[model samples]
Target: MAAKPVILQNKACTATYTTRGGALVDFRLQPGGINPLQFRHREKSKGSKEVFFNGHFVCLGNWGDPSAGEATRGHVKHGDFNRLQWLSSQKERQALLSAYSTLEGLYMERNVALDENAAVLQVTETVQNLHTVGRLYNLVQHPTIAAPFLDGETIVDCNATKGFDYAFPQFSENICKTWPCANAFDGETINLSSPDRAYSSVFSFLVNPADEWGWVTAYSPAQQTLLGYVWRRSDYPWISHWLHFEGELIRYRGLEFGTTGLHKPINEIWGKGLVSLLGESTCRFIDTGDTHHRSYLSFLHPLPKGFQGVKQVEVKDNVLVLTEKNTDHTIKISHQFKTKYAIQQ
Candidate 1:
């Protein structure tokens, strides 16, 4: 009983969203262009419930795994949001999708709208606690990029400041570094801004506390296109970058951002007191009958030849501007959307 995919279109872009788990299956610029978020094509992992981890799915209720006690209660590995079916309705270029997590007694409603004149998708998710008691939760936007949009020539740029490696064996978890430079498991330093098959790792970085918005961009010089996302820094303070490699080729890259950076079971996260490490909150608690809202914007932009990378992204007065790295060149898009935490005037 898998759900069918819904196509939402605009003059500049086309987006396909599947009701099953509410995963975004495809997002490509109009007129037959490359989709950078085609992770389903290279996905090889599935949960015990037979749900495939594909496309750009949200990791709600939890991020990685469930606690031992929760597992014994038949809890799925990454929570029920991605495994359960969601109800959806569409109106023109906007769609509303809703899903419930029976295990956690949480209800989620999402609204996705594509801009009429720009290649930008605006998403807002509202989570409400239905239980009698307060509950802790995690919500992560898992947008994975795969080939042929992802290759050695694709460059990833972000505004992350400090970060720590998750699975590095040689380096202590306390050891920290800035963005794009991480200590590999073999104790070697690896650059993350570009694709490199030298190391496959997962690293989480803290967004600059001073900035109101956090953004990540992937630019492919070969296709002369760029895909990027911007969200409220107050809502998603951490961004986790996962580099999955197979054999001698890079497979998928995860540009995940959420409330939690420690991708472990609940008990471990609390026992180790990794909640406030690096001054970033790992989990959020929702009081009974209370609701929380989070929103973000994802857009596609055409790049000029010899474009080095992204220098900065700015959103103001319902307009988005992107600056090219090491140059004064800029691209601007006009929209009617506003982020929860707009840049301070």
Candidate 2:
């Protein structure tokens, strides 16, 4: 039988999570509508996506592909959290899932909760090292957005001030640029919000993190809905903005936040110390039996009519306030997750 999912619902939204990989499969906003989070390649492709790549998955100990040298050290792309069937249970409006990945040498416990009357779901995941020797690691929250919700007119915003593109030896040279607007391969500066078939670029925002929090937002003008995320800048000070639009059935964008300066393997990130994440190394050094933790909040808000995009977002007194870019319209979200807390499982 397929691994069953635990359902968490409220008056405004419902979330479904599968035990396989403990992946969040669906997060529907309001009553009856499609989920903003897209599934991977359900639209008839030539090749198969063997690993379950849907919705959002926690990347523990690593994020992207590991270097050849690092691969010899037992590194896998996106870590090993998505390869295990997590054990799950629930209480009231919250669900708890736990699992241990021998490949990643870590045990993780996660807790997900939905607000009683708002389209907000909060998740907290903690990964503890189970190794006999110290290892280099990193953590990232990978949330991919796709069509029906992400369109040409959709606007992406964040607190990033200045950044540059990645200059891989195989790819083109990267240039330093500002946020939201950067030069694409076609030699024309394009807004990150707009989609282009010829655009193939990765913008790494050197996040000028807030004193306590950092944020990213996406507004679908066509859908009149806004998605927002807030997290600690100290824990994850780098944000990667990946945009691709090559084919109809294979295009998607990612608003990835993590503890690394770039989406590279520990080989490129460690001792060389090419970049620093909030005054620390991009690669983390975890001793045996030690634990690492972080917390974040994601909300799907039904916006007022004519809402173009967001100007500012901040947490105040257990409330999330979103200020409109060109108007006085502001959305406030009040919930337990407005304030950070440790994960309980």
Compare the candidates by TM-score and give the number of the best one. 1
Instruction: Evaluate model 2: give its TM-score.
Output: 0.88
TM-scores for all predictions: 0.93, 0.88
The per-candidate count of clashes, in order, stands at: 0, 0
lDDT by residue (tens digit), candidate 1, 1-345: 666777899878899988887889898987878888878742222233444677789888888878877776766656778777889999999999999988978999999999888888999889999989997888888999989988878899888988877885332445678887876666677788885555677888988888888999998888788999999898899988988888767888999888888777767777777667677788888899998988899999887669989888887878888888888688887887865443220
Ten consecutive residues with minimal summed lDDT in candidate 2?
41-50
- In candidate 2, position 326 carries an lDDT of 83
- Which stretches of model 1 miss by more than 4 angstroms? 41-48, 169-174, 340-345
Among the numbered candidates, top lDDT falls to 1
Q: In candidate 1, where is summed lDDT lowest over 10 consecutive residues? A: 41-50
Q: After superposition, how far is residue 329 of candidate 2 from its true place, in Å?
A: 2.5
Off by over 4 Å in 2: 41-50, 69-75, 167-174, 185-187, 195-197, 247-250, 275-280, 338-345
Report lDDT (Cα) of residue 40, candidate 2.
Answer: 69
